[model samples]
Target: MSSNVAGRVVCYSVLSPPRRSRREQIISQLLTSVGSLREHNRTVRVVVFWLGSRHQETEDRLRSLEAQVVHLGSYEDLLHPFPGGDVLVRYPVLHKYFVLDAVLEDLGTSQLLLIDCDTVFLDDVDKLFERHADVDLAACAEVGTVRRERGYDPAYLDEEHLARLAQSLGGRFVEPINSGILLLSRKGIEELAKLRPALLEITLRLMVGLAKSAEESDFAPLVQLRERLASGAPEVKGVAPLGFPSSNHWIVEEVALWLALGLTESLTMRDLPPSDAALGGEVYRRPRSASSWIIGHYFSVDTAPAMSWCRTGQPPHASPKGRSRAADELPIDPALAASPLLVEHEGFALYEDLFGLDVLSEMTREAREAYWGGQEQSLTARFGGVGRDSHPPRRLVSAGGGDVQDAAYCSPSLKAFLESLCGLEVEPTGRRGSVNYYTRSGDFMGLHLDVVQCELVVLTVLQDLSPADDPSGSWELFPGQVGRPLPSVSTGRRDRRSIKAMPGQSLVMFGGLVPHRVRPVAAGQRRIVSALCFRAGQTALEPPTVPQD
Candidate 1:
């Protein structure tokens, strides 16, 4: 099928039945995303599925952008109680059903793109359709436990109870999926009809019975509690039979539902067009083409700012010229610094051999199957790299009241590394919550100084370092400038001194002074570990140096 068959893409966010401020912010972000689409002369319909009385000004704003604005009124009149009108109204599940109903009834087009308003589209996403064939739904992988991780044992679920629940709901176990970015084709809409009533019932049980709060866990029930509530309904029980493969562990159960329902077999990115051709922009084509894309997810209110890139050299050490060291060794001890406490260094040159000379010139390719491997139960033991900042400031803490730096479902090695870097001595300011990990073809973070309050910037590159002639997986940093605009130098002109960080090695840079970014890894191999550490202080503290070059 031609790429244009992707049809006019419409992105929307269903705002709360309450909270005008949140609704406004969501509308603003939607508008901003639509504005980018407008600039490209694309027919991108933007809508806000709101609750309260519609505002003309808001509608006017969307109209000015030449995008559609929709406000889905409360359905209380259609059904007596409006099922979950109060507690579960803000959840996206019902809104999804409402939209699905419209689409199936031919009120809308063949393809629909639903996005969480919290996300900002750095570029056009129209290409998602071209690659989608045979798949009813297209979505990013939900990071979750594999069968191996789950230990193939039926005991994981109380079999008797699970059987009873499965019989009632018509499924066995529940898998997870991130509903943030959902791509539904016409086939998906039809399939959704088969599962709609059961799914709605499950969603309501989750919202009212299990989750109760706006924030919910995967296991929440939906059926209303009478004199005493029952354990679960048949639809909830049926989810287990799906047996979906868990890719992104963040929303494993949701993905499980998709797979259990036999929807997983219908999707693929193989046929999707390149983002550039679909979005129709210069910036989308070049991975490092834009500063905003380089600083992925910056200014997001959810998590602390992290320098999420890699380098190809060794850890920072005291230079013999600066202090009094040998010809070959880099300093790891923090006490050796002569300037105040934390000394700043910029560019990749200062970080020589960080990856080890031998490791820097090699390829360590893991099996592709193994590379994509993940687990759940064993997650707590393996990749935990370090402990996080103790005495975490209120802003950076999770709703769980734990440190925000903790990537909840990560391996133990990651946790250990986090613990080592984000000790009680160093606490990150503006630490909001755990960060979502993301990557793509030739994907990487570009050079920029971090605005967050952290002492050391640590990255563990996921891929092995290739030869100098093939530096596909090395780290690069821009020198002299801290959070400065892209220099007016000619295209392809780059500063020579920045270091290349290799896999397994870590670089602890004075984040404030060192303006740095990662070079995109086109193909070959590359991996990275990022941890932002801050200096200890009684109150919010700033680095003594200004961010200007």
Candidate 2:
């Protein structure tokens, strides 16, 4: 039953050594599912990559069902020299990534459909192939409902994980891609093959770093064993920086695939519609529609019983355990808890006390001295304007001291914390030169949205006088239109919300989205604030501004 024929869709499934009984049961169901594809008029072939010692009975069973089975030699060769070999060995599910490229090479098929063993076909997969014919890859997007049901939370990822994602995906994260069902064209397969070596090295380094950090755990012995095996291997180098382990080992494949696709030029990715019926482990029935459900994924809560029924030819038993609550109960790291609290509202988020009081106090003193020493300059003429008419002058002084920059923009913790809150990785715009604003009595900034240079603006209040001293000088936020000129500060618009930032408080706002201004200061008051700018992801440059009406 060699199905290595070209111009046909080869459906590939990898089965590593599982319990003998369970493996047989899954293969039986998988063969039946593959057989059903023929009735749907699909020109398809089924091939199973078995990673274990050759079992004649298993090979005979698959052949009887008209499916080809190839026994992959000792899996140890795939794991030996990699830096994170131990971790991979511990979690064998990750083996898919190491062997998938080789499987594709062996099959030599221009079109490949990779599915989990538990998945069943309810409809013709011909449409799926046609839909992705012009694209490099097509995969289902892991929806929020499915992720929550599966107990996966993106927020649980820490700074190092976020950094890896940023380096790999050009963003903090892309919509999670399910690895259970992947449709790859020849280009996509070749791309993965080309990037496999570098990707494996990086993945191993990250895993080794994580293992080294957990030296006292029960897992430490496994790492040591792997280290001994890798001692003579040239690929075994010093540990890389540590990052958090993914919720499941299979996530390694998803990450590697994403990175490979991202780095591969001339290849595009498209989302397979949820309606295409890629059901999860929830045991959802085939949807009643004009077309049948395309694929059913049995990797979730109900997989074992479904497999048991196929094995003994008996009704499936109720799942012994329901969905896992571990993900919900997972502890929030102390570092995350200690990060600044972001209170969100329409159009903005207010981060209370982002900087310590002592730091702000010292910075305030420096800014006041700069103003008094005549180092301040007028910023109104350059940045604040409504077409040709510039607003009244406001005093602007540099952060001047490196300490302020370190506290505000250069702190890794601060950057990570902000990224967590925003759910987007941000970087300094490199347009550094932050400034401290000093507004004396009678000074007021006009109502205008900030320029589109930065994705977000961080404002630290160094000194805010008491309401009694300066009730009129609070930052007045206008909610209605963006980019359009609003009525003057004295217009007393009922929609405006006045925000008073006390000393040490920080305000983080989507600069290009919210239009705001400074209220006129009272005679005895002086308002001082430090402002910094950041751009989200690498592509967020100076966006087009809203049209001025």
Candidate 3:
């Protein structure tokens, strides 16, 4: 197919199934992404490439819009070169590139947004182009999603990957890039197309590296992939393997794309605003704000992962209720200056009077009212790390909602103060704010990483009747122990430090990386605190990463 008119085109590469749910998903992406783009930019054309089994109704629906639907032959046809195409057919990521390559050939020098079918454009495509007009390509950095170290099983090493990539990339060690939402200029597209052969070599090398590093019995997928490469076969079995772990396959495509991008020296490139382009598995972690979410990429179409992913966030009826927030600039310069930084540890920070304390009055009053008003639940469970070994009993009073919840969800003052101290801009997360009460004698949470949750968490002591200095009923840290450990607070290790964020004070830390817990409450003591979550701010210059959900 040839484009009659195009300055830039928003392209989607899809592999749909016959299932009703999947059809609904495709329609959702179409309705949201195409709808949003059409509402904002008419100059940009929308192109849909169907790379799997075709359904006539969906094809007709695609035709109804300005979208030019391009039907690529079935996945089996794509695997023609692979002798036993059945094995790798399910994940057509590598083959998807062929469709994209065809697009470049037909469209010639038109700029493009090459994205996955599960992705939705939350904002204008034209505005995105104008904002990054200087760059030939832009994509989110995916270093956080893929691990660079070898675990018990063989894995790719970042150091070696970068060394090899840098050699081809003019001595630049570019971090891995996610191909989910790519913004590419004409030069970028041509350069990407040029990398076809080399990228294949890199991908095969990756398969070899993983195969070489492990025993054949350790990784079945690596063994099969290695065997196919050795025999120069296109497919493993006669057909695509059923119920394959598609996640790992997608990672290969992401790494291949990263290496391919690195090989391009003629084109200028940068990272897309991370918060704006919420990549696969990250869609849920992003805060529910329109300006904050300009794009979303779902990881899977399978019922299991997709269902869980869908539950992460609700479909917003509109952009948001108000105007976009101002960028958080540091050194808040509050006249009080009461919130002094006490000490900064590895991932934890100690502050005496954090700016979030200003809301303690209302927050505490609300918590008290809610607790007395019987809008609270007494939770009793042994909460610890991922391990379920020896967890101590934990009891706490939990309640949601108050006058301060909404304001806390996106607080500029606290964000400013945190940015000043941490030296990194942050955005308020936590879609709903809630209060945790440690009024019971055994109210304590064991050490655990927040994991796949907020990067930074702020805990403000709204009202603590316990002895401020007592370690029995306050927050405590295992001090730099990121390793997943079911550590007991009763061990009395000297490294264990109980934080004294007394009434009106707060403690902030990388909750996702650091291992922390709260001590049990004393018999007569009462403690109430509210937590505010945040993530490192995303900008075109920097990458935003939320741990994979």
- Distance from true location, Cα of 253 in model 3, Å: 1.6
TM of each candidate vs. truth: 0.44, 0.47, 0.48
The global C-alpha lDDT for each of the candidates, from Candidate 1 onward, is: 0.37, 0.52, 0.56
Summarize candidate 1's per-residue lDDT along 297-400 as a digit string, tens digits. Answer: 21213211111111111111112235432213222223213223233333111233334434322312211111222111111111110111111111110111
Cα-based lDDT at residue 451, candidate 1: 38
Worst 10 residues of 3 by lDDT: 329-338
TM-score between model 2 and native? 0.47
- Report the poorest 10 consecutive residues by lDDT, candidate 1: 389-398
Model 3: lDDT to the true structure: 0.56
Model 2 Cα lDDT, one tens digit per residue, 1-549: 333565445455454443343344455556656755655654466667777666677678667656677666656666767655644554444555554565565554677777766566556777777767887777776522233333444432233464475465453344456677778787777776676665665565555554544322112233453574467444345545435434322244455555445554666777777556454432332222333457656552234334443343332322124533222222222322232322245456667777777777777765554332122232232222231122333433333323454455767887887787766666665433244544444455656544333556788777656563445767777544433433333335686767777677778775544567777666545566777766654324344221110
Which rank order by TM-score, best down to worst?
3, 2, 1
For all predictions, the C-alpha RMSD in Å is 17.2, 22.1, 17.8
Query: What's the CA error at residue 221 for candidate 1, in Å?
Result: 9.5
Per-residue CA lDDT of model 3 for 268-365, tens digit only, reads 87777664576643454333453365666654332223333344343311123352212121111121122223234566776776654456677777
Judged by TM-score, which candidate is best? Answer: 3
Candidate 2 lowest-lDDT run of ten:
381-390
